[model samples]
Target chain A: MRKTLTTIIALALVAGGVAACGNSDSGGDGKIVLGFSQVGAESGWRTANTKSIQDSAKEAGITLKFSDAQQKQENQIKAIRTFIQQKVDVIAFSPVVESGWDTVLKEAKAKKIPVILTDRAIDSKDTSLYKTFLGSDFVEEGRRSAQWLVKATEGSTDPVTIVELQGTTGSAPAIDRKEGFAEVIKADPKFQIIASQTGDFTRAKGKEVMQAFLKAHKDIDVLYAHNDDMALGAIQAIEEAGLKPGTDIKIISVDGVKDAFVAMTEGKINVVVECNPLLGPQLMDIVKKVVDGQETPQRIVTEEGVFTADQAAAALPNRKY
Target chain B: MITWTRHRLFWPVMLLVLLLLSNLFFTPDFFSIQMKQGHLYGSLIDILHFGAPLILVSLGMTLVIATGGIDLSVGAVVSISGALACWTISQQSDQGSLGVVVMAVALSLGVTALLGAWNGLLVAGAGIQPIIATLILMVAGRGVAQLITDGQIITVNSSPYKVIGGGYLATLPFSILLVAIVVAATALLTRRTALGLLLESVGGNAEASRLVGIRSRGLIAMTYIVAGLCAGVAGLMISSNVSSADGNNAGLWIELDAILAVVIGGTSLLGGRFSLTGTVIGALIIQTLSTTIYTIGVPPETTLVVKAIVVMIVCLAQSPSFRAKVFRRPGFAPPAARPGEPGPDAAPAGPADPTETKAEVPA
Candidate 1:
């Protein structure tokens, strides 16, 4: 009899664990509960982004429902459905990729829950789907890296042979950054892209690709990597090839990671363009503005800065991410 | 056709050397190496070092393909094993301890072996198609890795773990040593024993072998387990090299490369007649080509096309029909219609049957 009773209790606990818990909020407590479907803790930047949002939500006394999609669009859609069911006042998500969110966005709209796009944008043509987009312009980030390269090699009449290590192919940043960089460098006939390849935005690939570039090109003057990790990897490659990275190959990259800053201080990297991943406080502010019926712009751009060796030295200690 | 070219390693070795020589035109110092802080540091060294993972994966793949079975889950297993090792190491109070890292390696290998056993059960016991059985894990293993990592790129800074991939022993990459050990062990296990012949027999004709005395099921299961063990070690190498477990990208599309390496090594997909040396050379050939691409200034966007074209040429050169058609003399004949035959069409001969004339397609 006792064994049967114990078995029944165990069965009940397992059953309870499987079911989704419903929110008990009726909005009478004067707190706006926000449901956020994140694009998972993909990188250090993403982890910091999540932290900022959660911390900001707590500061504003808003009940935040957080869900990590682990970089899957399907998971994001499921999380959105759960948010709609919970009747949260606001929903925000950083999409894993553009497109394929029309159905879920329409359902959220039907439920009268405003959706926000943070960090990344969606491809839905219907402008009414998202309340606003708040993120860095990746194209502009690319242009900044190119602009720095052009200035650093301004007076030289000699051709600047460049090798580009792109991020994941077909990603928004990879495509837009290539475009923006190409647009800025096209006018200058001396800045020739000798080689360009996708490193898949990982350290090992970056290292491997950079090793190849070093072997292929004896006169490569500029190395433009898509992200800090790739640049860091190239630094190792360049060093192993017995060439000074900052001197022999002027390294320019995006994403102001802490390691990038260290690399700059070590004379391995020349320039780093920032694409700020920390958007929590601003995200929370917009949520409040939306709640108070204040006018919020259709798009908001984060304030970001470019870092050189001197700038990296000053900012490395204070940089949150 | 000459007997020399018929040897499996002939074309692959020639292609590798040709590719390496091509490097000299772009980078004059392609073959130069220098000692740096008691370690070998050069592009050639880097090829052997970075190529270690591919070498290991394709080594296991060669055996699997020899059994007439494919394991699509090797890439996924690589991710899972790396994730497990990194996760376990990170949880320890001392990440750099020899005992902890050893335990982590054991734990990761153990789990992946079980996964291999699971695949073996499906293919050998349940009689499921090997491709489909491995494909199930191929799709689901990444999710399992993501769960273990909590959807984060788990980075561990253990010095002992660092030694596995990045450290040097006797002025050579520690990774190269690991590769050598694994390759040597695999060669010895097969060549020095009866296992190699047994595998060939089973793969060459499973039903016939079963009718005889061979336990084909046990042998098939053993191959999958070995493949899992190989992928597990590769995972450790990759994660240790980067000091991180990236669930999504850890071993992405590596299975395709391994299969390619196995095919390039002169292993027929129809099974039987495996070559460990040929597979090693094939893996090196691939590594050299990739390294040469960067050194030769191939455009990044078209790199894949360039590689595909070169691989095609090498494969085409090895094709017997192509050789017979192109290399045939003006008076060439098909071995004089076999001396015992009364006429050209007296009876069905080797590969002369139209139905048996299927081109060997490597998957």
Candidate 2:
């Protein structure tokens, strides 16, 4: 008899706890409740991206529910389900990977909650699951880098020998950036890619691989790094090899991080193609529009700019990331 | 000749030489060292310089594995140590001041020592399994590092700090010199003292060591502390080389590499005999393999697959049982006796004997 009573009390307590958790103040006062799931703080760019979204939500007076998935797809799905349970007005997330998000999106769709993708997109055939996708075009960023390289070497008839430092193997940005650069550079017969290798998007690997490249090929004329961090690393390797970075080899890279801008001012990096991480204000605007039952574009591309060494000093003060 | 060939380091050393030589097929200057600006510049020098961090971490891992403990948290400790040092340097009024750099190094090493002590307490004092104990720090230490750097890459411009990793000492990279000093010091400390024997005893049989009045708990804890100090210095080298601390990416998966180096160096995970020389050779092989991939122009997508295959071949060569099975010729010797067993000359003991015989000393 005593055991049965204890069991009944324990069950009642669990039920009470569940009830308390379910009673969240989501849209209770007719205010917008936005659920945003972010990728983990893996790099400076990602940290800045998270901060932009948070700061923008406050400025827009939207009650934001933020969750960090820590680079896991399952955590993201769990966060979305909780948002659905709370009946949030809108849901948005940066998918860690490009696949395996269809089931969660379908669940959100079944509940009539509008979903938005940020920073990274998902791979799904059903377009009706999410309201819109907002991010940068990595391929365009790569093309811009190649175009800048071509223009910088316009009058010189000397064949350009380029050594490429790619990002992690099989990543979306690495694939797109390589494709876009190859597509543009193929037009010029003088532009030749002598060697290319993956730096895994880290400074140490970049420097190590660049050192090997220097030893293997002494006549390298150009270097194209997929990210600014790798470019900065390659600059160090180039300097250590007793060669001037910007002058001896015209260095071109993507992701206009603050360090890259600093390098440009120092004349170590020649050009940086911007991949803006500050998409918070725009993401908030989209969320407000979707919540108000307004039409949103299927894809929203953030506007980015290219900065050269001459423009770096003037742009350094305004750089956010 | 038989004795020389039977030495544990022979296979790993041969593999290292083979990997370095294979690079010659692609780059003819793979072995040439040029004097440029009073410093050595060559592919060989780059391998040693880049492989220094791995060597230091593997040296520490050797001792820990000898004591029957696995430190999965060394990678996290590496990230934390670098993050703390870079963050401290960034906060200073004069980031380039030698005094500030020294303080940052001391502070980072001190904190990592404390983390090591925490792991030690969990394993030695609480009697928790070593893998699970170190695993706790492995997961949380990254978060702690991210907090220290405020979830961003902390970049510092300190010439004094850079000297530790990138600068030249005696016309060689400072990182290579640092690894040499640490490896030599560890060799002397372990071989010239009774600490090694006691560690072997503890790992061979905890109860026997306890009965022998060896303070197994304290000894185990000290090995972890030493491993932490080694990893802390490696962290400084890595961050100083890059001039930045990336909480998420710095020293990521380095623990696995260190463990691989230790295993390849002839240290058993079961924890008995260990070799420092073999570990150094193993680290060089891994670094050389990485350089070879770039030099030979392996496709970026297949880089990992190539590395995996090379590692597998080296591991197979190191396995005596595999060799014994493959080469069943009359001239070929049988597999060496299991560790902690009597030599062929001695009277054979019972196979079920739990007590370990300290017949052979680790070279």
Cα lDDT computed for each candidate against the true fold: 0.83, 0.87
Clashing pairs in 1: A216-B295
Per-model TM-score versus the true fold? 0.79, 0.91
Worst 10 residues of 2 chain B by lDDT: B345-354
Summarize candidate 2's per-residue lDDT along A1-321 as a digit string, tens digits. 476568769999998898677556678888799999987776677788989999999999999999888677788899999899989999999887777888999999999999999977777899999999999998898899999988988998889999999987655678889989998999999999989999977788889899999999989999999998888889999999999999998899898888899999999999999999999999999999998899999999999999999999999999988
Which candidate leads in TM-score?
A: 2
Q: CA lDDT of A141 in candidate 2?
A: 85
Off by over 4 Å in 1: A1-42, A50-116, A121-131, A150-161, A182-192, A244-248, A265-267, A284-296, A311-314, B14-43, B88-103, B125-128, B204-211, B307-363
TM-score of chain A of each: 0.89, 0.86
Q: Give the runs in model 2 whose Cα sits over 4 Å from its true position.
A: A1-30, A69-88, B329-363
**What DockQ was computed for model 1?**
0.38
RMSD of each: 6.4, 4.9
